[model samples]
Target: MDTDADARVAAGVTALSERSTERAGDEFTRAAWLSLADPRSDEELSPFADEDRGWVGEGLRWLVVAAVSYRVAGREARASRRGVEGIAVARDLQTTRSHPAQRACLDEFVADFRVAAGMDDADAAYRTAADAYREAGDAVDDPHRLATSPLFRAAAAPIEQVARGPANGEIAVEWDDLHGSDPSDPGAFLARRATYKRQRFPSLLDRVVDAGRLAAPRGTTEYGNDSFRCPDCDSTDVNWIAGRTLCLRCSAPMARA
Candidate 1:
Protein backbone atom coordinates (compact mmCIF):
# COMPACT_ATOMS: atom_id res chain seq x y z
CA MET A 1 0.00 0.00 0.00
CA ASP A 2 1.36 3.42 -0.87
CA THR A 3 1.93 5.57 2.19
CA ASP A 4 0.56 8.59 0.35
CA ALA A 5 -2.67 6.79 -0.47
CA ASP A 6 -2.86 5.31 3.01
CA ALA A 7 -2.50 8.65 4.77
CA ARG A 8 -4.90 10.50 2.50
CA VAL A 9 -7.63 7.83 2.70
CA ALA A 10 -7.28 7.54 6.47
CA ALA A 11 -7.58 11.28 6.89
CA GLY A 12 -10.69 11.47 4.69
CA VAL A 13 -12.47 8.59 6.45
CA THR A 14 -11.48 9.73 9.94
CA ALA A 15 -12.81 13.20 9.26
CA LEU A 16 -16.05 11.94 7.68
CA SER A 17 -16.63 8.81 9.74
CA GLU A 18 -17.11 10.98 12.81
CA ARG A 19 -18.25 8.05 14.89
CA SER A 20 -15.70 7.51 17.65
CA THR A 21 -13.69 4.31 18.09
CA GLU A 22 -16.07 3.56 20.94
CA ARG A 23 -18.77 3.35 18.31
CA ALA A 24 -16.79 1.66 15.48
CA GLY A 25 -15.75 -1.01 17.95
CA ASP A 26 -13.95 -4.35 17.44
CA GLU A 27 -11.39 -5.48 14.89
CA PHE A 28 -12.93 -7.63 12.18
CA THR A 29 -11.63 -9.71 9.28
CA ARG A 30 -12.08 -8.44 5.70
CA ALA A 31 -14.58 -11.18 4.85
CA ALA A 32 -16.65 -10.58 7.96
CA TRP A 33 -17.09 -6.89 7.19
CA LEU A 34 -17.83 -7.52 3.49
CA SER A 35 -20.90 -9.58 4.36
CA LEU A 36 -22.47 -6.42 5.76
CA ALA A 37 -20.78 -3.65 3.73
CA ASP A 38 -20.87 -4.82 0.12
CA PRO A 39 -24.38 -4.41 -1.31
CA ARG A 40 -23.74 -7.38 -3.61
CA SER A 41 -22.96 -9.76 -0.75
CA ASP A 42 -25.64 -12.16 -1.99
CA GLU A 43 -23.65 -12.73 -5.19
CA GLU A 44 -20.72 -13.92 -3.05
CA LEU A 45 -18.35 -12.55 -5.66
CA SER A 46 -16.37 -10.40 -3.21
CA PRO A 47 -12.92 -11.81 -2.55
CA PHE A 48 -13.51 -11.60 1.19
CA ALA A 49 -14.64 -14.76 3.01
CA ASP A 50 -15.73 -15.00 6.65
CA GLU A 51 -13.50 -18.00 7.33
CA ASP A 52 -10.77 -17.09 4.86
CA ARG A 53 -7.17 -16.64 5.93
CA GLY A 54 -6.49 -12.96 5.18
CA TRP A 55 -6.90 -9.42 6.41
CA VAL A 56 -9.74 -6.95 5.77
CA GLY A 57 -7.22 -4.88 3.79
CA GLU A 58 -7.40 -7.69 1.23
CA GLY A 59 -10.93 -6.65 0.33
CA LEU A 60 -9.96 -2.97 -0.06
CA ARG A 61 -7.28 -4.17 -2.43
CA TRP A 62 -9.97 -5.88 -4.51
CA LEU A 63 -12.16 -2.83 -4.47
CA VAL A 64 -9.19 -0.79 -5.65
CA VAL A 65 -8.40 -3.35 -8.33
CA ALA A 66 -11.97 -3.19 -9.53
CA ALA A 67 -11.81 0.57 -9.55
CA VAL A 68 -8.54 0.53 -11.48
CA SER A 69 -9.94 -1.93 -14.00
CA TYR A 70 -13.13 0.03 -14.26
CA ARG A 71 -11.03 3.06 -15.11
CA VAL A 72 -8.45 1.34 -17.32
CA ALA A 73 -10.07 -1.86 -18.64
CA GLY A 74 -13.62 -0.62 -18.74
CA ARG A 75 -16.45 -2.14 -16.66
CA GLU A 76 -16.29 -5.87 -15.97
CA ALA A 77 -19.37 -8.04 -16.24
CA ARG A 78 -19.63 -9.41 -12.73
CA ALA A 79 -21.40 -12.56 -14.00
CA SER A 80 -18.48 -13.47 -16.28
CA ARG A 81 -15.25 -15.39 -15.57
CA ARG A 82 -13.14 -12.53 -17.00
CA GLY A 83 -13.69 -10.76 -13.70
CA VAL A 84 -10.88 -12.97 -12.38
CA GLU A 85 -8.38 -10.70 -14.10
CA GLY A 86 -9.17 -8.05 -11.54
CA ILE A 87 -7.75 -10.31 -8.84
CA ALA A 88 -4.26 -10.14 -10.30
CA VAL A 89 -4.38 -6.38 -10.43
CA ALA A 90 -5.56 -6.39 -6.84
CA ARG A 91 -2.67 -8.57 -5.70
CA ASP A 92 -0.18 -6.34 -7.46
CA LEU A 93 -1.71 -3.23 -5.93
CA GLN A 94 -1.81 -4.65 -2.41
CA THR A 95 1.77 -5.87 -2.54
CA THR A 96 3.07 -2.68 -4.09
CA ARG A 97 1.04 -0.06 -2.27
CA SER A 98 0.01 -1.17 1.22
CA HIS A 99 1.49 -2.56 4.42
CA PRO A 100 -0.48 -4.89 6.72
CA ALA A 101 -1.81 -2.56 9.45
CA GLN A 102 -2.35 0.20 6.92
CA ARG A 103 -4.36 -2.31 4.88
CA ALA A 104 -6.38 -3.04 8.02
CA CYS A 105 -7.30 0.63 8.19
CA LEU A 106 -8.42 0.53 4.54
CA ASP A 107 -10.55 -2.53 5.27
CA GLU A 108 -12.09 -0.89 8.31
CA PHE A 109 -13.06 2.39 6.63
CA VAL A 110 -14.59 0.82 3.51
CA ALA A 111 -16.80 -1.33 5.71
CA ASP A 112 -17.50 1.62 7.97
CA PHE A 113 -18.48 3.74 4.98
CA ARG A 114 -21.38 1.35 4.36
CA VAL A 115 -21.99 1.06 8.07
CA ALA A 116 -22.51 4.83 8.23
CA ALA A 117 -24.77 4.72 5.17
CA GLY A 118 -27.45 3.07 7.29
CA MET A 119 -27.55 6.12 9.52
CA ASP A 120 -30.12 8.87 9.00
CA ASP A 121 -27.44 11.01 7.33
CA ALA A 122 -26.27 8.69 4.57
CA ASP A 123 -24.57 11.45 2.61
CA ALA A 124 -22.04 12.21 5.33
CA ALA A 125 -21.05 8.57 5.65
CA TYR A 126 -20.62 7.98 1.95
CA ARG A 127 -18.76 11.23 1.47
CA THR A 128 -16.11 10.10 3.92
CA ALA A 129 -15.39 6.84 2.07
CA ALA A 130 -15.73 8.33 -1.38
CA ASP A 131 -13.52 11.29 -0.63
CA ALA A 132 -10.82 9.06 0.78
CA TYR A 133 -10.52 7.10 -2.45
CA ARG A 134 -10.75 10.27 -4.47
CA GLU A 135 -7.98 11.91 -2.48
CA ALA A 136 -5.73 8.88 -2.94
CA GLY A 137 -4.73 10.25 -6.39
CA ASP A 138 -2.11 8.22 -8.30
CA ALA A 139 -1.78 5.87 -5.31
CA VAL A 140 -5.21 4.79 -6.50
CA ASP A 141 -7.85 6.76 -8.43
CA ASP A 142 -7.99 10.36 -9.47
CA PRO A 143 -8.97 12.71 -6.68
CA HIS A 144 -11.28 14.68 -8.97
CA ARG A 145 -13.51 11.79 -10.08
CA LEU A 146 -14.78 8.30 -9.33
CA ALA A 147 -12.52 5.56 -10.67
CA THR A 148 -15.52 3.46 -11.69
CA SER A 149 -17.12 6.47 -13.37
CA PRO A 150 -20.90 6.39 -13.99
CA LEU A 151 -20.76 2.92 -15.53
CA PHE A 152 -20.18 1.42 -12.09
CA ARG A 153 -23.41 0.34 -10.43
CA ALA A 154 -24.02 -1.23 -7.09
CA ALA A 155 -24.54 -4.89 -8.12
CA ALA A 156 -27.60 -5.69 -6.01
CA ALA A 157 -30.45 -3.13 -6.17
CA PRO A 158 -29.63 -1.29 -9.36
CA ILE A 159 -30.10 2.44 -8.88
CA GLU A 160 -31.45 2.55 -12.44
CA GLN A 161 -34.30 0.32 -11.34
CA VAL A 162 -35.11 2.61 -8.44
CA ALA A 163 -35.08 5.69 -10.67
CA ARG A 164 -37.58 4.00 -12.99
CA GLY A 165 -40.33 4.39 -10.36
CA PRO A 166 -42.91 7.17 -10.62
CA ALA A 167 -41.61 10.72 -10.70
CA ASN A 168 -42.34 12.95 -7.69
CA GLY A 169 -45.22 14.88 -9.27
CA GLU A 170 -46.67 11.73 -10.93
CA ILE A 171 -47.41 10.33 -7.47
CA ALA A 172 -50.42 12.32 -6.22
CA VAL A 173 -50.24 12.84 -2.49
CA GLU A 174 -53.07 13.66 -0.11
CA TRP A 175 -50.95 16.53 1.21
CA ASP A 176 -47.90 18.34 -0.18
CA ASP A 177 -44.97 17.20 1.98
CA LEU A 178 -42.32 19.41 0.38
CA HIS A 179 -43.06 23.13 0.42
CA GLY A 180 -41.77 23.46 -3.15
CA SER A 181 -44.22 20.84 -4.45
CA ASP A 182 -47.15 23.24 -4.41
CA PRO A 183 -47.67 24.83 -7.83
CA SER A 184 -48.75 28.19 -6.45
CA ASP A 185 -45.43 28.53 -4.56
CA PRO A 186 -42.82 30.77 -6.21
CA GLY A 187 -40.24 27.96 -6.43
CA ALA A 188 -42.63 25.20 -7.45
CA PHE A 189 -41.62 25.35 -11.13
CA LEU A 190 -37.90 24.99 -10.38
CA ALA A 191 -38.58 22.22 -7.86
CA ARG A 192 -40.26 20.26 -10.59
CA ARG A 193 -36.95 20.06 -12.47
CA ALA A 194 -34.94 19.04 -9.38
CA THR A 195 -34.64 15.48 -8.15
CA TYR A 196 -36.55 14.65 -5.01
CA LYS A 197 -35.10 12.62 -2.19
CA ARG A 198 -36.31 9.03 -2.07
CA GLN A 199 -37.23 7.05 1.01
CA ARG A 200 -35.19 4.00 2.06
CA PHE A 201 -34.59 2.43 5.47
CA PRO A 202 -31.02 2.02 6.71
CA SER A 203 -29.14 -0.13 9.27
CA LEU A 204 -27.24 1.58 12.09
CA LEU A 205 -23.43 1.62 12.35
CA ASP A 206 -23.28 -0.04 15.77
CA ARG A 207 -25.67 -2.72 14.65
CA VAL A 208 -23.18 -4.18 12.12
CA VAL A 209 -19.61 -3.50 13.35
CA ASP A 210 -19.25 -6.71 15.31
CA ALA A 211 -19.19 -9.34 12.54
CA GLY A 212 -15.86 -8.05 11.23
CA ARG A 213 -14.16 -7.51 14.57
CA LEU A 214 -14.77 -11.12 15.56
CA ALA A 215 -13.61 -12.47 12.23
CA ALA A 216 -10.31 -14.35 11.98
CA PRO A 217 -7.23 -12.12 12.07
CA ARG A 218 -5.32 -11.44 8.84
CA GLY A 219 -1.55 -11.51 7.95
CA THR A 220 1.04 -12.74 10.42
CA THR A 221 -0.38 -13.90 13.78
CA GLU A 222 1.14 -15.37 16.93
CA TYR A 223 0.85 -18.89 15.48
CA GLY A 224 4.09 -19.60 13.59
CA ASN A 225 5.08 -22.49 11.34
CA ASP A 226 8.44 -24.30 11.42
CA SER A 227 8.32 -26.57 8.38
CA PHE A 228 8.60 -26.29 4.56
CA ARG A 229 10.11 -22.84 4.61
CA CYS A 230 10.55 -21.26 1.19
CA PRO A 231 13.96 -20.87 -0.42
CA ASP A 232 12.96 -18.53 -3.25
CA CYS A 233 10.94 -15.87 -1.37
CA ASP A 234 11.57 -16.98 2.21
CA SER A 235 7.79 -17.39 2.67
CA THR A 236 6.61 -18.77 6.05
CA ASP A 237 3.47 -17.08 7.37
CA VAL A 238 0.86 -19.62 8.50
CA ASN A 239 -2.83 -19.49 7.56
CA TRP A 240 -4.86 -21.74 9.86
CA ILE A 241 -8.39 -20.68 9.00
CA ALA A 242 -10.83 -23.55 8.27
CA GLY A 243 -11.09 -22.82 4.54
CA ARG A 244 -7.42 -21.93 4.01
CA THR A 245 -4.59 -23.62 5.82
CA LEU A 246 -1.74 -22.24 3.79
CA CYS A 247 1.22 -19.85 3.71
CA LEU A 248 0.23 -16.21 3.55
CA ARG A 249 3.71 -15.11 2.49
CA CYS A 250 3.64 -17.00 -0.81
CA SER A 251 0.11 -18.39 -1.46
CA ALA A 252 1.44 -21.89 -0.99
CA PRO A 253 -1.48 -24.05 0.20
CA MET A 254 0.55 -26.92 1.63
CA ALA A 255 4.25 -26.54 2.29
CA ARG A 256 5.99 -29.77 1.28
CA ALA A 257 9.60 -30.27 2.29
Candidate 2:
Protein backbone atom coordinates (compact mmCIF):
# COMPACT_ATOMS: atom_id res chain seq x y z
CA MET A 1 0.00 0.00 0.00
CA ASP A 2 1.07 3.56 -0.66
CA THR A 3 1.86 5.82 2.29
CA ASP A 4 -1.37 7.83 2.08
CA ALA A 5 -3.39 4.63 1.98
CA ASP A 6 -1.44 3.36 4.95
CA ALA A 7 -2.10 6.59 6.83
CA ARG A 8 -5.85 6.21 6.27
CA VAL A 9 -5.83 2.73 7.74
CA ALA A 10 -3.93 4.12 10.69
CA ALA A 11 -6.51 6.86 11.15
CA GLY A 12 -9.41 4.44 10.92
CA VAL A 13 -7.80 2.16 13.48
CA THR A 14 -7.08 5.12 15.71
CA ALA A 15 -10.71 6.24 15.46
CA LEU A 16 -11.83 2.74 16.45
CA SER A 17 -9.53 2.78 19.47
CA GLU A 18 -10.68 6.22 20.55
CA ARG A 19 -14.35 5.28 20.29
CA SER A 20 -13.79 2.10 22.29
CA THR A 21 -11.78 3.92 24.94
CA GLU A 22 -14.44 6.59 25.32
CA ARG A 23 -17.01 3.92 25.97
CA ALA A 24 -14.67 1.97 28.29
CA GLY A 25 -14.10 4.95 30.59
CA ASP A 26 -11.91 4.23 33.61
CA GLU A 27 -11.14 0.71 32.48
CA PHE A 28 -8.81 1.99 29.77
CA THR A 29 -7.32 4.74 31.94
CA ARG A 30 -6.57 2.39 34.81
CA ALA A 31 -5.14 -0.28 32.57
CA ALA A 32 -2.95 2.30 30.83
CA TRP A 33 -1.68 3.46 34.23
CA LEU A 34 -1.02 -0.11 35.31
CA SER A 35 0.94 -0.69 32.13
CA LEU A 36 3.27 2.18 33.08
CA ALA A 37 3.14 1.78 36.86
CA ASP A 38 5.84 0.17 38.98
CA PRO A 39 5.67 -3.59 39.08
CA ARG A 40 3.09 -4.83 41.57
CA SER A 41 1.72 -8.21 42.64
CA ASP A 42 -1.45 -9.50 41.02
CA GLU A 43 -3.15 -9.31 44.38
CA GLU A 44 -2.29 -5.64 44.72
CA LEU A 45 -3.82 -4.86 41.34
CA SER A 46 -6.99 -6.89 41.91
CA PRO A 47 -8.89 -3.95 43.33
CA PHE A 48 -9.28 -2.29 39.96
CA ALA A 49 -10.74 -5.41 38.37
CA ASP A 50 -14.19 -4.38 39.57
CA GLU A 51 -14.55 -2.01 36.62
CA ASP A 52 -17.11 -2.85 33.93
CA ARG A 53 -16.02 -5.96 32.11
CA GLY A 54 -18.46 -5.47 29.23
CA TRP A 55 -16.95 -2.22 28.00
CA VAL A 56 -13.46 -3.44 28.73
CA GLY A 57 -14.07 -6.53 26.66
CA GLU A 58 -15.48 -4.43 23.83
CA GLY A 59 -12.43 -2.20 23.94
CA LEU A 60 -10.26 -5.28 23.71
CA ARG A 61 -12.17 -6.47 20.65
CA TRP A 62 -11.39 -3.15 19.03
CA LEU A 63 -7.71 -3.68 19.75
CA VAL A 64 -7.84 -7.07 18.05
CA VAL A 65 -9.48 -5.51 14.98
CA ALA A 66 -6.84 -2.81 14.88
CA ALA A 67 -4.07 -5.39 15.01
CA VAL A 68 -5.72 -7.46 12.32
CA SER A 69 -6.19 -4.38 10.13
CA TYR A 70 -2.49 -3.51 10.38
CA ARG A 71 -1.54 -7.02 9.30
CA VAL A 72 -4.07 -6.95 6.48
CA ALA A 73 -2.87 -3.56 5.26
CA GLY A 74 0.75 -4.78 5.29
CA ARG A 75 2.02 -1.24 5.71
CA GLU A 76 2.93 1.42 8.25
CA ALA A 77 -0.39 1.98 10.02
CA ARG A 78 -0.69 3.38 13.53
CA ALA A 79 -3.30 2.69 16.21
CA SER A 80 -3.65 4.88 19.27
CA ARG A 81 -4.76 2.49 22.00
CA ARG A 82 -2.70 -0.45 20.72
CA GLY A 83 0.34 1.16 22.25
CA VAL A 84 1.51 0.41 25.84
CA GLU A 85 -1.88 0.91 27.52
CA GLY A 86 -3.68 -1.21 24.98
CA ILE A 87 -1.37 -4.21 25.44
CA ALA A 88 -1.71 -3.87 29.20
CA VAL A 89 -5.48 -4.04 28.94
CA ALA A 90 -5.23 -7.14 26.74
CA ARG A 91 -2.89 -8.83 29.25
CA ASP A 92 -5.30 -8.09 32.08
CA LEU A 93 -8.11 -9.71 30.09
CA GLN A 94 -5.94 -12.77 29.47
CA THR A 95 -5.32 -13.27 33.19
CA THR A 96 -9.06 -13.46 33.84
CA ARG A 97 -9.42 -16.46 31.55
CA SER A 98 -9.15 -19.96 32.98
CA HIS A 99 -9.11 -21.57 29.52
CA PRO A 100 -5.51 -22.30 28.68
CA ALA A 101 -5.87 -22.08 24.92
CA GLN A 102 -7.70 -18.80 25.07
CA ARG A 103 -4.95 -17.25 27.18
CA ALA A 104 -2.35 -18.61 24.79
CA CYS A 105 -4.20 -17.08 21.84
CA LEU A 106 -4.08 -13.67 23.46
CA ASP A 107 -0.37 -14.17 24.09
CA GLU A 108 0.19 -14.90 20.41
CA PHE A 109 -1.80 -11.82 19.45
CA VAL A 110 0.40 -9.54 21.56
CA ALA A 111 3.59 -11.16 20.34
CA ASP A 112 2.54 -10.90 16.70
CA PHE A 113 1.45 -7.30 17.18
CA ARG A 114 4.92 -6.38 18.36
CA VAL A 115 6.58 -8.41 15.64
CA ALA A 116 4.40 -6.86 12.93
CA ALA A 117 5.23 -3.34 14.14
CA GLY A 118 8.93 -3.89 13.44
CA MET A 119 8.72 -5.75 10.15
CA ASP A 120 8.48 -4.37 6.60
CA ASP A 121 6.33 -7.35 5.64
CA ALA A 122 3.87 -8.31 8.42
CA ASP A 123 1.53 -10.42 6.29
CA ALA A 124 2.83 -13.76 7.58
CA ALA A 125 3.14 -12.67 11.19
CA TYR A 126 -0.42 -11.33 11.36
CA ARG A 127 -1.81 -14.26 9.39
CA THR A 128 -0.34 -16.71 11.91
CA ALA A 129 -1.72 -14.67 14.79
CA ALA A 130 -5.18 -14.56 13.20
CA ASP A 131 -5.18 -18.29 12.61
CA ALA A 132 -4.28 -19.02 16.21
CA TYR A 133 -7.11 -16.80 17.37
CA ARG A 134 -9.55 -18.63 15.07
CA GLU A 135 -8.49 -22.03 16.35
CA ALA A 136 -8.92 -20.92 19.96
CA GLY A 137 -12.37 -19.59 19.16
CA ASP A 138 -13.40 -22.89 17.60
CA ALA A 139 -12.28 -24.86 20.66
CA VAL A 140 -15.08 -23.63 22.89
CA ASP A 141 -17.54 -26.51 23.54
CA ASP A 142 -19.58 -25.62 26.57
CA PRO A 143 -22.68 -23.43 26.44
CA HIS A 144 -21.57 -21.85 29.69
CA ARG A 145 -18.46 -20.69 27.90
CA LEU A 146 -20.67 -18.71 25.52
CA ALA A 147 -22.73 -17.28 28.37
CA THR A 148 -19.68 -15.89 30.07
CA SER A 149 -17.51 -13.41 28.14
CA PRO A 150 -16.20 -15.41 25.17
CA LEU A 151 -13.47 -12.99 24.23
CA PHE A 152 -11.84 -15.26 21.71
CA ARG A 153 -14.95 -15.82 19.61
CA ALA A 154 -16.02 -12.19 19.66
CA ALA A 155 -12.55 -10.84 18.93
CA ALA A 156 -11.65 -13.40 16.31
CA ALA A 157 -14.75 -12.96 14.17
CA PRO A 158 -13.38 -10.14 12.01
CA ILE A 159 -10.01 -11.81 11.59
CA GLU A 160 -11.61 -15.03 10.50
CA GLN A 161 -13.99 -13.28 8.11
CA VAL A 162 -11.41 -11.10 6.42
CA ALA A 163 -8.87 -13.90 6.15
CA ARG A 164 -11.25 -16.55 4.78
CA GLY A 165 -9.83 -16.79 1.24
CA PRO A 166 -6.69 -18.55 -0.03
CA ALA A 167 -3.69 -18.48 2.29
CA ASN A 168 -1.55 -16.32 -0.03
CA GLY A 169 -4.44 -14.39 -1.59
CA GLU A 170 -5.49 -10.83 -0.98
CA ILE A 171 -7.69 -9.98 2.03
CA ALA A 172 -11.03 -8.18 1.70
CA VAL A 173 -11.76 -5.98 4.70
CA GLU A 174 -15.36 -4.81 5.31
CA TRP A 175 -15.71 -3.25 8.71
CA ASP A 176 -18.83 -1.02 8.93
CA ASP A 177 -17.61 2.41 9.98
CA LEU A 178 -13.94 1.89 9.15
CA HIS A 179 -14.31 1.29 5.42
CA GLY A 180 -15.34 3.76 2.76
CA SER A 181 -17.79 3.35 -0.18
CA ASP A 182 -16.19 0.22 -1.62
CA PRO A 183 -15.58 -2.02 1.34
CA SER A 184 -13.90 -4.82 -0.57
CA ASP A 185 -11.22 -2.51 -1.87
CA PRO A 186 -9.42 -1.63 1.36
CA GLY A 187 -6.99 0.77 -0.26
CA ALA A 188 -9.70 2.83 -1.91
CA PHE A 189 -11.82 2.78 1.22
CA LEU A 190 -9.01 3.89 3.50
CA ALA A 191 -7.83 6.59 1.12
CA ARG A 192 -11.30 8.06 0.80
CA ARG A 193 -12.00 7.79 4.51
CA ALA A 194 -8.67 9.49 5.22
CA THR A 195 -9.80 12.55 3.36
CA TYR A 196 -12.92 12.74 5.50
CA LYS A 197 -10.94 12.13 8.68
CA ARG A 198 -8.47 14.82 7.71
CA GLN A 199 -11.26 17.40 7.38
CA ARG A 200 -13.47 16.28 10.28
CA PHE A 201 -11.23 14.94 13.06
CA PRO A 202 -8.00 16.57 12.03
CA SER A 203 -6.74 17.29 15.51
CA LEU A 204 -7.87 13.97 16.94
CA LEU A 205 -6.16 12.01 14.16
CA ASP A 206 -2.88 13.79 14.77
CA ARG A 207 -3.08 13.13 18.51
CA VAL A 208 -3.82 9.46 17.95
CA VAL A 209 -0.80 8.78 15.69
CA ASP A 210 1.48 10.95 17.80
CA ALA A 211 0.57 8.99 20.93
CA GLY A 212 0.88 5.69 19.06
CA ARG A 213 4.63 6.19 18.59
CA LEU A 214 5.15 4.71 22.05
CA ALA A 215 4.01 1.28 20.85
CA ALA A 216 5.33 1.44 17.26
CA PRO A 217 8.45 3.56 17.19
CA ARG A 218 9.83 4.64 13.82
CA GLY A 219 13.49 3.58 14.00
CA THR A 220 16.38 6.05 14.04
CA THR A 221 17.80 5.04 10.65
CA GLU A 222 19.35 8.20 9.21
CA TYR A 223 17.62 9.57 6.10
CA GLY A 224 20.69 9.79 3.84
CA ASN A 225 21.64 6.14 4.42
CA ASP A 226 21.58 3.78 1.45
CA SER A 227 18.61 1.87 2.88
CA PHE A 228 16.58 5.01 3.61
CA ARG A 229 16.45 6.45 0.08
CA CYS A 230 13.00 7.53 -1.10
CA PRO A 231 11.60 5.15 -3.68
CA ASP A 232 9.84 7.91 -5.63
CA CYS A 233 12.19 10.88 -5.76
CA ASP A 234 15.30 8.99 -4.66
CA SER A 235 15.86 11.87 -2.25
CA THR A 236 17.51 11.35 1.14
CA ASP A 237 15.60 14.28 2.67
CA VAL A 238 12.95 12.28 4.49
CA ASN A 239 11.23 13.15 7.72
CA TRP A 240 9.08 11.12 10.10
CA ILE A 241 5.71 12.60 10.94
CA ALA A 242 2.92 10.75 12.77
CA GLY A 243 4.61 7.39 11.98
CA ARG A 244 5.08 8.08 8.22
CA THR A 245 8.38 8.64 6.43
CA LEU A 246 7.87 11.28 3.72
CA CYS A 247 10.27 12.60 1.12
CA LEU A 248 10.81 16.36 1.34
CA ARG A 249 11.43 16.77 -2.37
CA CYS A 250 8.32 15.13 -3.85
CA SER A 251 6.22 14.94 -0.64
CA ALA A 252 5.75 11.24 -1.19
CA PRO A 253 5.76 8.63 1.54
CA MET A 254 8.97 6.58 1.47
CA ALA A 255 8.77 2.83 1.75
CA ARG A 256 11.37 1.33 4.04
CA ALA A 257 13.67 -1.44 2.83
Which model scores highest in TM-score?
Answer: 2
- Report backbone clashes per prediction: 7, 0
Q: What lDDT is reached at residue 250 by model 2?
A: 37
Best by lDDT: 2
Candidate 1 on 42-103: residue-level lDDT in tens?
45433333321223333433233222212122222321221233233233434533423223
RMSD of each: 21.6, 16.8
List candidate 2 stretches off by more than 4 Å: 1-55, 67-85, 98-102, 115-149, 164-257
Cα deviation at 51, candidate 2, in Å, is: 12
